[model samples]
Target: PVVAAAPGPKEPKKGQKLSGKIAQIGDNGVFVSFGGRAEAVLDVAEIRGEDGNPTKAVGDDITATVVSVGETVKLTLKGKKTGDIAGLLDAQKSGTPVEGKVTGVNKGGLVVRTLGVRAFCPFSQIDRRYIDNPQEYVGKTLTFVVTTADDKGRNVVLSRRSLLEEEAKGQAEELRQKLEIGQEMSGIVARIRPFGAFVDLGGVDGMVHVSEISHARVNDPNSVLKVGQEVKVRVVKVEDLGGSSERISLSMKQLESDPWETAVDKLTVGEQLEGKVVRVVDFGAFVEISPGVDGLVHVSALAPGRVEHPSEVVSPGDAVTAWVTQLDADKRRISLSLVDPSERSERTPRFDRGDRPPRRRGESNRPPKVHRSGDPSDGLTSMGEAFQRLREQMGE
Candidate 1:
């Protein structure tokens, strides 16, 4: 009768969107205040996490849709459904995720089918990695986010890379927590460079320096490591670069026992062992007595005679028997002798008698008498007299 019932507070229609502040949180639901004293109630189940705890609190600004409009409004979060364009549009507006199937590969990107709607995924947005063969993605189902969706659903853009990066970020955090120095891990060699090889461990990569590829000397990493080869490595170091990036140092040699630890026990001084000459220098030849163990055969010790260069006695790849003369375990050094120990000459005392005693004032100059197997005092007394005369002459 009066003014057509005053429009009944202009009730919002179902599926209509509204922005408001969370007025209060109750045991069963939360009340939101919108424009002109309009209020809506949201179900507690919508805001509760998997642990059965509320995710939202009072005074927080929230945007929700009107699910039902009666004496009081019932609200729901956007993008709750994904089977229709309305839901997809809501996902695009709210930055939510959706599922799609890769239909074909185009020059620009990938063709995706979602909710019976055609969507384009650019090559760069198709994956976190550079797509070398886009054909592999065809007929594969994947999850993506609706980056752009028009109201008419005529043009839609999807990004699987964004979702992949987010997932990798979380996985990277978990890996970093579990990784530690000296921890051993199995990985695949992803690439080889002159300096090192990059190994993929789970979702991260670590570098294995050429020197660390094996216990033996490594001239080129490609010779020992190839791409797609599986390897076992030890984590020598890990440096966090912040924001899901880290630098890791790995060593394949560290996983093996050090040869030097057993070299001293297995190789005894004066014992002869067969070895191969691996390298030759001006001073000595390096011979590999055992795997990852080397001993030096000096030029002077190559033979009983004088020698100028080590190559003359032992060339590279020469097989020879060597005597272990000195083993410096602390310095990881081994001194080898190519000349047999039995052939070495015994040292003897040599003295010149001309440098002995000079003539005394009244003494006759003559040769001293020699005795064989005589008393020890007789020989000692004559030697002592000669030394005294020599000292007196030197003082003059």
Candidate 2:
């Protein structure tokens, strides 16, 4: 009878080590099935990878330490010395910056899912460039630095801009070496500011100044160009003012046509043309006869009658016939006259009159009038005296 000792019933206890298969994975946590029954709940923070993603996934058979064995056994990878989730988190916390995909975006920031962990990246931390629409970042992968983590390890904050700024700092040096003045390169318009547009030239960004957008004057970069427009630009200047950053000046107009050349050809003195009124100032109206070809009609020359302001005579978009009275080829200045008789048929006066004197040899006809002062009975004076007295009387 010594052969059969009663086998003791297995004792279930709390804080015991166990192994299970991951039954399900969700946004909040993962579920695992232990030997005896109900599944165990593991928070997302407790089930992370070395890179910060979940270490155990659905259908994964893994060992976990049981922290509580009641109606349900609560297992924590963090509690296990052998299967320490903290080790994974610690490794993630210590490792180099990781790459993340922008999964969602909101008013405050972007929701980035990286290494199985969800992180919040504030708008300021999203990119180095100004982000007018942050929603564009969704589904894009970016490198990010872990700026903060919650005590319960629930909320992790990330910063892609910090990583980008660091990377740009290094790349800027390299770009400075390769970038030379007058070098032509392709770029995308990254941002449009009041003063200029920032162009993304490969790794570095250069500025396409407002004046450089066109050979003609540019009032605003936003008017002529927009964000994300691809354009070719020339490097106009590279100034190492010796600050924290170097300034790179770029120009799109330089790569394009010289407006002055076309303007000089298209707009010459005595060139009669029709134009649309572009602008009206107190001094004159600016008419664009062609692309980049503009002429200014002074207020005095706007009409046969006096005009206080050019706007009084013509509004914007009005088509008008004008004569190019003067042209400065080098300065690209064209003086126009709206009142030139050739421009308006209705404004010209007729030469035919019934009372004009008869034509003489080599003499043109002149208008005739009744001679009241020269009548002898009315004057009663010498002809010269009468003419002088009449001239004085008429205040001639």
Candidate 3:
């Protein structure tokens, strides 16, 4: 006698979303029970993290869309069977975000399965900036907003960029309303441009200008800052951009104790100390006597004999013993005289007003002084320049 096979449960249509619990696991894959005869298999690799551990377990509730209907159904982490054209229209009209799974990467951009429809997300719309490796997004679940939902070829255009920007804007506005000037906070370096490092403050980006990166002079920001570096910064400026958006200027050095706060007591006049020659300018060579502290060695003090140029006596990076001749704490100036090692202890430095050559008529009786740094009067532009540089980097 011949026997006929019994009929199985009805097949689930492709793109149809289903929620169920993991019923069993084996070498082939995980079998998900649809609470009925129909069961779908999820790739074992798909439900794992970097640690190679399963993110789901037996009886764990999981939601997936029927990607293929065969003898055994296949499911993916796609969104609410919004794969219907009507569901997409509702999302487009409501500005609601829909979930999708990146099925694959193509030259145009990513091929996404959302609302049960195949959508095209241009490469530019994948991120706020250029995306170098689009493949990294494959098999990953992400949220997106419908940009163009025309029913032609079932053309459904989506943009993760739009969703990200909207979220960022809302977050930025909320932060601005509560963010106070002079507030100190920690942030991650998000982007580094020619002018400065853009720090991500939760959602808003604040600029840490090149001039404010540190107390030490930095010609290249890249030399000190790297993307994703955590830094403590102080909010120095906040300005409204007429609406929800605003600009924030932050300073790293402000969070640090100004090195010149104790300059007067630290560098006593006539004291001899060894320092490294940091810079050799036309007027003199600047020596770093301490961290974030530089003193100028005038050309006249380069040697016992007349010196035509400061460089003629000391080149940069030369370690030398020099005597403090003059210090103007209010002006943040320190004058040093390079002396022969043998004569360092023989005589007091001839740096006081009593030892100075007589001033010509109309000249101040004070000793001549040149301030190369610390006062902020010259050598470097301050906040205005910093903000301008940031503007150029932003194209604003």
Candidate 4:
């Protein structure tokens, strides 16, 4: 009698997932049952727990992926695995990312435990930006790419910033496709400067100038924005600066109704309003009538008479009353005349009654010399001749 032919060793297909019980744990790798005589062998380094140690026993429930099928099925934990010295070295050469937990911090940098070995991550390597509080990273597990490593993995160095940079580079094209003028997006404030705040819009950076930060005056960007704060901004402009560089202008002010729109409706000619002087120039002073609305008080209208400069009559932060003489909403211009309290009840802001101003200091208190229609002394006297009278009195 002929016996039925026996089947060859059952081979698992490449990338096929397998679920089985641990058959054996050896110094080289793990052995898991794969139904028939064909067994699954996986490197011990593939399944390291979060504490940087291999904590598996025989017969333990485990899952693995079939990476290759030779005489025996070679298995893996899929994706990128980092749990041994060999793994870190491979990552260093291949530029693959590894996993690490920030255990503590030191003077030089952070102390990270990865793949059962301690690694150093310098403060500068933690992020693309400066890190103020290094301790905040403790107890956080992060992915890192190996920058340097020795054969024993005792001198391993890692950087998260490099990985972030690579990711940003990879996403740049996608970001360009998404950005559009007038489109609103949410982002985190990455940094603050004197002129503006830089917001990280995923993989790109957008600038919100201080003038665009608010409708009210913003003298300091720090007062209105902070690092890592989430904010919504509208894309006002997108310009290609050059190859590999672009500019994005964002605005927070444009999201709200302009304050000038309302201020213009209520401000009519001869309307009296009280405001604080916000700026002073040689020609005029700017008085803020509302939060973001202001009017110009010309030097001629700053005082009851002629004003040499606006600073002489009105200074910054000075509270004053003024009447609007001209308001142009389309031009965003308002002309104001200061209301001198001394003559407010009798006349308007302009006090040009054609009266001679008071004499300046160290000047003659006497009026000008009056003469007949044909007299020689017609408001004109030579300095030497005029002082001759004083000379005769003093005998000089």
User: Which is the leading candidate under TM-score?
Assistant: 4
lDDT of 2 by residue, 1-396 (tens): 458876664434666676778999888877887656467766665665433457767898877777776676677774432322243356457855877788777668888776656677898887776677887888888887777765454677788877777777787667767878889999889889999999988657889889788866577788888777789999988876335576789988887776668676665577779998988998999988776668899997898876778878899889998988898887778889888756455664546686688767876456644454755787445557767888898996
Q: How big is the positional error of residue 73 in model 2, measured in Å on the Cα after superposition?
A: 11
Clashing pairs in 2: 49-53, 53-115, 53-116
Better of 2 and 3 by TM-score: 2
List the candidate numbers ranked by lDDT, top first: 4, 1, 3, 2
What ranges in model 1 sit over 4 Å off?
1-169, 243-246, 311-317, 344-396
What is residue 71's positional error in candidate 3, in angstroms? 31
At residue 267, candidate 1 shows an lDDT of 77
RMSD of 3: 22.1
- C-alpha TM-scores of all predictions: 0.46, 0.60, 0.53, 0.60
Each candidate's number of clashing pairs is 0, 3, 3, 0
Worst 10 residues of 4 by lDDT: 45-54
Model 1, 1-396: lDDT tens digits are 556655445567898898889998887778998863467998764675422346888999999999898788989888743237787799998888888888777678888878866678899897655555788888888999999987645578999989878887787667778998999999878778899999877667789999888877677888877776789999998886344566899999998889889888887899999998889999999989987899999897897877888777788889999999998989999999998888864523247788779977878767756544435776544556667889999999
The window of 10 residues in a row where model 1 has the poorest summed lDDT is: 44-53
- Evaluated at residue 330, the lDDT of candidate 1 is 93
Please say which candidate is ahead in lDDT: 1 or 4: 4
The global C-alpha lDDT for each of the candidates, from Candidate 1 onward, is 0.81, 0.75, 0.81, 0.82
Please give the ranking of all candidate structures by TM-score, highest first, separated by commas. Answer: 4, 2, 3, 1
The total number of steric clashes, by the backbone 3 Å criterion, in model 1 comes to 0
Off by over 4 Å in 4: 1-83, 151-154, 241-245, 265-274, 321-326, 341-396
